[model samples]
Target: MTGTPDAPVADVRPVVRRHHGDEFIDDYEWLRDVEDPDVLALLEAENGYTEARTAHLADLRETIFGEIKARTRETDLSVPVRHGDWWYFSRTVEGLSYAIRSRCPATPGDWTPPAVEAGIEAPGEHVLLDSNVLAEGHEFFALGAFSLTDDDTLLAYSTDLTGDERYTIRFKDLRTGEELADEIPGTSGGATWSAGGTHVFYSTVDDAWRPHRVWRHRLGTPVADDVLVHEETDERFFTGIGRTQSEKFLVIGASSKITSESRLLPADDPEGEFRVVLPRSTGVEYSVEHAVVGGDDVLLLLHNDGAPDFELVAVDLEPVLTSPLASARDGRVVVAADPGMRLEDVDVFARHLFVSYRRAALTRLGVLDIEATGFGPMREVPFEEELFSCGLGANAEWDQPLIRIGVGSFVTPSSVLDLDPDTFETHLRKQAEVLGGYDPADYVQHRTWATAEDGTLVPVSVVARADTPQDGTAPALLYGYGAYEISIDPGMSVARLSLLDRGFVFAVAHVRGGGEMGRAWYDDGKMAQKRNSFTDFVAAAHHLVAEGWTSHERLVAEGGSAGGLLMGAVANLAPDAFRGVLAAVPFVDALTTILDPSMPLTVIEWDEWGDPLHDADVYAYMKSYSPYENVQERPYPAILAVTSLQDTRVSVVEPAKWVARIRATTTGDAPILLKTEMHAGHGGVSGRYDSWRERAFELAWIIDTAAGAPASTS
Candidate 1:
């Protein structure tokens, strides 16, 4: 690869799209045709340009990749989780690309995970499915819907060979070590089996890639004879199927951004019609879990009915099934929503209830004991770290005495613990092994506040080497993902050490569009207030600079998907704020995609971005900050837009068009590069090794750009 290469120019075919009395011209819209030879050639040329431009950093990229590989334990086993008669876990081999799912026979009544040494396999281990073997010949492979029957005699799994989300479902008879004759195609990647293991329920996506239908397949029956049990007609709603913790009820759930409806059928009665537990109402989202309290079947409902942050309520099972809407309103409140905490989810066990919530931008887990005294006080599960992510792990059995919890932070490797509700004691089950001598003492992680334009305080998690200077002279990478009420929690990464070891500070901007600060934080950043996500990100960059952590000349902004949209918007909104930008599968063409309801996921995203095609106000509001439309003739920072040709959520055309337009419009000579993965999806390449290599490439480019390497325009 040479240091200098001519930038490819895309053929401009102006396509006019009009909505709400507004007209927009998309110059490179024709690039959406993925099969076009010219389009492929253009993408290939851009990839070549990127390779030539970054050829000087090849050694650095390899070094980073090596560091990542060395730090990771190539051959390891996860903590074994006990379910019924077996202890199940997954193991990784040295050269394999995927995990080998296996299980061992359990000594009845043993709730504790089987203790196994780092390199030792468990006794009597039987391999159920080896993803490495399944993915041997596939370039891109994703395993989904790994479900087992109650009897443990059969296994059902799904796989997606292409980047598209559609998966194929297949069954295997564990006893015979052979795949069954039944094969189902094009599913939503989830399956639930009846208690008797006689029937399996799965969901299928519509033309828009929305899971809209649920079907039941009796064992040994042909695919054509499968019964469609439920179908959600609302374009905004998605459907899924799952079983309750008690394994008594098979649930069909239909949900949108703000509304939800659930139907339940006895797991023993697979052919029975499902009865609605609650009717869907606008702006009311609720989830239900079944439990037996005081010898009576009860339904625990977590809903945002009167509390925006959500609250927990309990109702008698029969009453809820008889008159769901009324019973839901009359239900007794179990845990009222607090301003400082957002009730995220509730998992019910036979004798206790576990609740997971977010408080002050950190995760917290609480347990409620169910005894003869009705219900005990909600006890908080404690963690030592001031900044870490903790949540409930796999606790599949309802009669289990221990609760599984996972905890980790920026400097700490992930650890699994088993908590005894009776004694309030936790037993350390396993902690991820960092092979190449990792020491937490060498690093520092902390939280800092950034004041948004609207006077809202946003939390930013920053981690760096202990010896790194605070004099604003070091390079920094600021990451942000502030959409869909998703919180970007601080967690440990073996690959990230490559940056910190090289005198770089890594920070996560918990902006308004994220759930870190609660539901209100997310509400304040979406729809008409969407610009807050971008401005809040900019504010975080400024805060880091003002605090002497790093300066604009040494800063690189990074985000993917909606956050990638953020990278694009910030480039247009505050071009001089960062030295470089790395956007992966960016949703840059917001207004254009959102305006076309016919596109995949367009209608489903209306609740988050608003219906830009129908509402003039929404159209104008989105148009004001739509990155592609707002690009100006300014000296923008160097940009590396990474995308995949087979991405379904955000089309590859988005970043391709954005890079083309930015290159054509920006006055700066800073290189604008696009790298499209021909055989990957939204999450990029599937294998761990492939993913690490990709990260090393991106980080190397970032490190180079921060060190003041201008694009070679020769």
Candidate 2:
């Protein structure tokens, strides 16, 4: 594998795919016509053979992109947050690639926040929409829908520019800074307004990009007289549109990967009609929030019906806004199911409700107190970092007398405090500065576990640099995703401090299809127990190499989109445990994109990967772990993958056909590669110094393949 650069083969055209009686053929399904010019010249010859095999790590990718732009503090700002009589924030401008939004005024009762400083602006600030002047000439820019009104005098944003998550919307009028002729176009960047800010609502998608309708518009409108309001014709549901922080109702919602529904109306009756509330079932899941309690109004919800780590309850919002289908299952429990806590949402706050949940695998938060009998006791909210990650940040004012929260931890950096809720006190308000002189007690973080050959302990977390080395001569990484119950929690990463100041280590795993340790550890790793998320990520890489902390020849593994299908099914299930893998944007041709429901989020990922096109034992349990139908021949570790070609969620022909079938079915010589991003999408290169030079070219190929490992043949 020395300076190897030749690999761009992928042109096979077989294509047979016969369901359950299972015929399967497929050879690079013609790299799914990414507008074929030979699939854009084979993704520009696999991005020029991954820039000539990483041209000997171009000076270690410009010294890890100048140590992530010198420990990043480049003109920062964000903390403001008040909303209503203004305060909001967002700055960043040392050679800005985007982010400027502004606001200022708020002092009516001064709930404190104001420090402002950074490149100095504040006193009546105002600016509002500068995303570096709308990401000038876009090679991918984002910000979809910003929203405003509750007398902030109209703003409603949105703008995508081509990372294909579609969005366009417009409007502004912050009382004369002018701009609204009301634009609209394609949408789904999210919007919601109405309390007499003259109707906005939003949502749109379809053509398998999902979202499916919602609409409304109005403020001097004509986007063909807008109005639809609801649609979600079940391509396994999706739709959305929000509002209620007691600005009184708007909601909408729809959801699928395990059912959900909602509807509501009256944010001052935007032409009133909505209604529903519960009516959904099939493996029920719930969410809604709005509260009032003593003067009775309520909703709260959270639900996972018979609670497999979910349960909050408390319904009766005037009989679901006066009966139109009122069915939140007769409410009244307000946080019960604690099979080791998982709950997740509920924010309300006039006199407090917050919540958020997760417990042992971390991310927690609590508050409660809106009692005239209903919610008084919760309270938890403490934090001194034992593997941290706190929640509920920008408290947009529903009688905001404090409570922002944010926190962080793999050796902490993200920090934002405020709390109070009538004296649980806490204050802090800003921590992320980290420039080169950085020091989080020189890093260290903890939690360990592993187990899982079906017994299942899992957990992991780690972090390093407190003079790195838990014995096995350090060089770890690890990471993992597990799938939809999402949870890869413990945070902080200023480009992961160029791999913990070079001795590496990192970690994460937590395995079992993720919502960490709850919802029955994501129903035991999804669909027919999805090979318990690839043998719980190969039992957390053989328990981080039998606990010496690293050496399976210096371990690497990583993940992305469904944890790049758990780094392509643990490189076909533990290809000699590691030395490299990466996988960003990788859903690695999972049974030809979940047996194609015309793709794009494959019918709401059949309740988190199952109905393999009408289940023949979920097409033999997803063709026995579909990482490009289990690429074989043997030995494979050095990989990379990354992707984009306008990724409408995983499809740069599934990592250009899984790096052309692992360089034609690898048997050894481990150099795989791929790259792609031709003007990005699926969150790739959208400028923050081109995403820190794409994380310094994937941390200079994970520090030259973990310092080209190959020693402990133990």
Candidate 3:
């Protein structure tokens, strides 16, 4: 398996797969066996080849890593949030790789975050959980659920040590600093406590990694005795449990991609049966929040029942929860859906409602006063930035006077703001500490539009040095993720400065299948129209070249997960448009994965990708654009595919197989490398330092490839 960079070959063991009268041969299908010694050997050989090919850029990788470390404040404390009698927060020590969760007594009438200086721990801080200690012996550790009881005496938390999504939940007494015997394993990373704190509800995943069942665990009870509260048998729907904002009911929600059904159990009645709020409809999606309007218990429903975008409506809880046929449309409309804006989410407070929406490809927050006269007009939360991302932060308390929000742009570091609902005045709690000198004036951030093939204007956000000449000579990195209606917003990143300082321009393509423009934008890029996302990205690249931002020889494209799917498609669609492509945990084998229902998350994803297993039309449509099946014997950009051995979302084999096929089929001499993390999940490494090193390695490769440097040999 060990070979030179120019001719590294993977042993081919062809597997024939047939679906809908179509046949395809997968030559590298044997790479799926992670436990096989030969498969492991091949992965190691590929890793060695990648290392040998990039050994020349070792200095560059270190420089970038050092720049990132220097810019970030190693020792810092987050804004302290006041919950009940405690002002809870987390802080990072200079050398530690994780945060220490702590809390102190809250001062009377003080709703603002406590003032804490950098590098100094707060007085009387009670350390609840130290992630560093928990992660000390494990190669991968993720702190999942961190829920405290209403009395604040006991803490319930979950941990995943193997990078698998399954978590083990444990209880600890905050006052005595003693661990409880109530250990629950195989949870789905969330736990909601009853009002009496005697019982807690948690969810568990099925073999396919879909959260399928909710269970009730009583204090001091044996794990075998825990009751199964609700079970969702439908594979298409995933289930989750949470307490409503009013703290009156426990919500168990079952949802597929397009439809949702919620069951409510009163917080006071821990042994009561859960009742459905509304029956699930084929194409309707809605979320419910408990609220007290006009002294009546009402449910605030954010639904797209009739409105394509989404509308906020007030439904009488008594009727909707009691009747199976009652729909949210029978309720009074509060905030009617607007064609131009897409309502992303709604947060309910005691006296106000915070609505997060997107318009003109930017996130905006609006506050509405919940008064006796229905609801007041929504007032937009003011942000001065021309292109930035802002949304609600951690507001756990239902009746808090001030709402916490996070705001940042490409050039601006993230800042925590406390906004007053009544006065609309925002108080800065803390701005991100960049240790090395950082000046927002030294960089430029702006939005540009590219005309797609269908003449649709697509948004592109670009950031570069203020004085960098847009002469089509400087190298550029274009990133895009257009799936699941998820928006890749403009946020602060200290690691990105390394590229900007090196005369590289960075841009994000707000293509369709993303919520940047609106729900319509996402609708236009998903299902049968999914090809629009890939083509839109290519159009953005062409626009960048035509507008003198960069040339085809100096452009590098990147994306991860579904976005990685985007990278693979674009590489096949327009290979000459970029100098290199970097895909992380890519879903390249879409057709094969979607056809197998047993694959993790395959059934739950049918709404987004269409059901290809049974429908021949969908099978043919997906087959036409599926990256692995569509790979042609043509010149391709320098490609790097990175995956993780433990990733269940997009299997590691997808990338391994895709890389092998690309390397064997492409006619060009450019390097096609595959790097797999042997002990990580969908998200790469767990620790901050490990993640930084991985990113530095990637940026170094992109810089080297964009510079047209020849691949290094052992």
Across 1-714, the per-residue lDDT of candidate 3 in tens digits comes to 245455458898888998878889889888888899988888888898899888878988988888888888888888998888899999888888898999999987779777876677677888899999999989999999999888899899999998888899999999999999999999989988998889988999998999999999998999999999999898999999998877889999999989999888789899998888888998999888888777788888889988888999987787655665377787788888999789888888889988999999999999889897678899998889999999999887888889999999999999999999899888999889777778999999989999999999999999998987899987899999999999989987888887887788899999999989888899999999999999999999999999999999999999999999999999999999999999999999998899999989999999999999989999999998989998999999999999999998999889988999998999998899999999999999998899899999998998898875322210
Greater-TM-score candidate between 1 and 2: 1
Q: Model 1's lDDT to the true fold? A: 0.89
- Tens-place lDDT per residue, model 2, 1-714, is 565767778768887889868797878787788887988987888888888988878877887777788878789888888887878898888888888888899889898978888898889898879987787877889998888888898888998888888888898888788987778878878888889788888888888798988988778968898889789787988988887777788888888988888888878989888988888888888878788878878777888777778788887677777674444456888768878888888889777887788878888888888878788878787787788888888778888778788888888788888878777777888888878688889888889898989786899988887887778878888988877888988888888777877777889888887887877888888888878988888888888778888887778888888888888988898878888899998888887787789878797888887888887988888888888888899879899988888989888888888788878988888678888888888879887998898888887788778865322111
User: Which sections of candidate 1 miss by over 4 Å?
Assistant: 1-3, 708-714
TM-scores of the models, in the order given:
0.98, 0.32, 0.98
Comparing candidate 1 with candidate 2, which one achieves the higher lDDT?
1
What tens digits encode model 1's per-residue C-alpha lDDT throughout 1-714?
A: 244778888888999978777888889999988899988999999999888888888988898888888988888888888777999898888888899899989998777677765467678878899998898788999999999998889999999998798899999998888999999999989989998899999999988788999999998999999999999888999999998888889889889887988898888999997888878889988898898888988888898887899888887788655565553556777887788799999988999988999999999999888775356788898889879999989877889888888999999989999988777798999888787778999999999999989898889999998998999998999999999999999799988888888888999999988999889999998999899999999999999999999999999999999999999999999989999999999999999899888788889899999998889999999999999999899999999999998898999999999999999999999989999999899999899899999999998899888965232211
Give lDDT: candidate 2, residue 179: 88
Worst 10 residues of 3 by lDDT: 705-714
How many clashing pairs in candidate 3? 0
